[model samples]
Target: MTDVVATTPGLFPLPDWAKEDLSDLKGHQKGDLVSGGEGGEIARAYDRVRNEVVDDQTDAGLDRFVEGQARWDDMLAHPLTVHENVETGGIVRYYDNNNFYRDPRVTGELTFSGDVAAELEAASGLLGSDADDRLQAVLPGPYTLADLASDEYYGDEAEFLAAVSEFLAGEVEAFPAHATLFLLEPSFVTNAPDDDLDERASEAIDAVAGATDADVVVHTYWEAFAEKPYAHLMDADVDALGFDFVAADREANLECINEYGTKGDVALGLVDGQNTLVEEPGTIAERVNWVREQVPGQEFDTTYVSYNTEPFYLPTSKHVEKLSAIAEAARLAATEGVEA
Candidate 1:
């Protein structure tokens, strides 16, 4: 029973209480820094969004993700922009303006940097020891980072991707000692061929698996798992994989479940985190049962319900708390009919 595992939806939007403008900390500190004020505004935005989704109980869908996209654009344009500073009595500071992906000017290291580490720690604190409970850190995989940052960061994408892979390996090695599971997300892999993507991803995955002693799960979302390049991810790491049950094309999902049913640990993103519709617990339980029936034996491991995608940050604190409750309930329901 103890070995039974689960995870909440990835990337919930930052709550209003957690949101911050981050425009002020533009050029003050050097290392890692936490800011207030505008930062608080950013958190507040997410909180509000979370609240609405939970209360409205409608199918909010991916449109919710668009709000954050606006903020992301600005951040991408000026990756160095800062808001308020908290380390120095709320003074403003600026990031190196470096992209998390492979930025030549910015070293393509995957280990937790300053600001990123602080964010993880805070999220971990919120989840407490449960951070390791079906824990999955949705960090951008090195390969995807390189793909996104290539041209912008390096002249050669392949060389840059390799560098990113090495860095990602470092990050995974660090996770097992700290968190329960390492969910390396390569959202961009869906864009290219599996052969083109697999070698780099495998290098990083193997490095992370070898480096750490804990269970490792690799995931991808925001795109269909079977379409284009994603079908290849199913065969990648054999142990842990997350899929978007709701957003993934239904036909493709059936094929995916059938293909991966016998080998890997599959995570089902049944709940609508991206939408406003608050799914009923019974509906979620039914889906879990369907999966169990599809693959009768211990072909793999248990199926877990997660948000189809991360929740947007416009919801309120109350909304996030509700989501946490939904996650717990879904876990309980999932375990009832299956052998843990």
Candidate 2:
């Protein structure tokens, strides 16, 4: 029997209390807070928010918990934009969404300074002994980072990609042993690279995955990959590849799985993260069974039922409801068996 786990791909809508705390701290610049000029109040606020996020996930009965990247103001560009070597440029629209992130302009060599690892350590501290069994670390994949960045130093696309990959690998190496590592690579579907560059991209992903013992999942959202890109993605040495079942091309995504078959475990983005409508447990379970039936003879060791992407688009209350729904749906799917 396949085990269905309830989890998310990271980033959550900030709670109201957290928003208030952060708003008050906004008067003081982040640099001053980071440099300990403001008594580290900003850090303390983030810590409290992370703790609340963990508690909420635990109460919802999720099998895994993310650090709830509450401090990431710019989503995918946070790590690079904060680095001294990279300059923050004009705001660019994030994918096709209304959200915008300041473009990271690479002015010097990309280097890892434990940006994400520090967040992971703080999150692990919250879970205590159970952290090793439950904590999941989330970060932007090298390809997405490189794609979003404006390279002024490397001058070459492949070199820039390699450097970014190496930088991320360093962060992964520094991470404490955890349950999962979610590499969010939305660009793979929204703006996929040329076929000739597919091998290099997969190699970049493999390099990051090889650095950690955690179960590595390359998650893509916004849309599903076409046949060739999906095939190239399967070539990567990751434990699982996540697909957006809520996207318009979901049927094509299922077809890709049927055609190529998965290498190991599979993460089904059954919950629509962008929408506020809560799906019933029975509906979600039926979708899980549908996926299983669509791809016969292909056995998945574990099926992770999660949001198609982060639910940062929703309000905190709705986000909480969605989290509960995910856990309940996973339970129903496992209890009823795939045939049901």
Off by over 4 Å in 2: 26-39, 337-340
Over 216-257, each residue of candidate 1 has an lDDT whose tens digit, in order, gives 555555555544344444445536666666766655655655
What overall lDDT goes with each candidate model? 0.45, 0.86
lDDT score, candidate 1, position 224: 56
The TM-score of candidate 2 is 0.96
Off by over 4 Å in 1: 1-6, 17-115, 121-136, 152-154, 182-189, 227-235, 260-262, 296-298, 317-322, 335-340
Q: Which residue window of length 10 is worst by lDDT in model 2?
A: 30-39
lDDT of 2 by residue, 15-60 (tens): 8887787778745543233646454888878888889899999999
